[model samples]
Target: MSTKRYCYSCDLKNDSKLIAEYKAYHAAGNAWPEITKSIKDAGIVDMQIYLTGNRMFMIMEVDETFDPVKKAELDAINPKVQEWENLMWNYQQELPWAKDGEKWIPLEKVFQL
Candidate 1:
């Protein structure tokens, strides 16, 4: 089956201590089950995040059912997700081009092989 791929970028507070903590939080088996469940429920077939210094890049592959707007709406009502986001904000910073309160900014693909 085909999948839709999306990329996003965000930054963490430019501090080594906070960045280490953020990485540890996302380590294997470290994330809350409910948060993973919510992600799967949103039609995200796979997701991976990479980091360099304070910047983060996420690669997400989703099924045909995925809708970003719908995902946001679902996340809004889920207290667990909200909790996770609020906690993450302690380490994350909005990219300068991001809209206010936006964490992940969508990355535009400019070149492909």
Candidate 2:
């Protein structure tokens, strides 16, 4: 099945120690299974996050049935997802130009092949 792709970016706190810890948490056999399952259940076919310095970029591939707003609503009601997000927030910071409550800001596609 063909999937839709979404890209987003966010910033991490400038603290080196915290950034290291955050990276460790996302390493193999470290990320919480519940969070991964939640994403899959939300129709996300695949997801990947890349980090450089204090910046983060994420790519998500989802099925045609995926609805970001609905997925967010579902996540909000899931305890494990909420816990994971809260913990992640400790190591993350809003972008300089982000509005209130925004974390990962969507990146517009300027070019596509």
The TM-score leader among the candidates is 1
Tens digit of per-residue lDDT, candidate 2, span 1-113: 78999999999999999999999999987999998888889899989999999999999999988999999899899999999999999999999999998999999999979
**Clashing pairs for predicted structure model 1, backbone only:** none
Listed per candidate, the RMSD to the true structure in angstroms reads 0.6, 0.9
Each model's C-alpha lDDT? 0.96, 0.95
Off by over 4 Å in 1: none
Global CA lDDT computed for model 2: 0.95
User: Candidate 1, residues 1-113: lDDT per residue as tens digits?
Assistant: 77999999999999999999999999999999999999999999999999998999999999999999999999999999999999999999999988899999999999999
For candidate 1, what is the TM-score? 0.98
Candidate 2: worst-modelled 10 consecutive residues by lDDT: 35-44
Clashes of each: 0, 0
Clashing pairs in 2: none
Candidate 2 deviant stretches above 4 angstroms:
none
**Which 10 consecutive positions of candidate 1 have the poorest summed lDDT?**
96-105
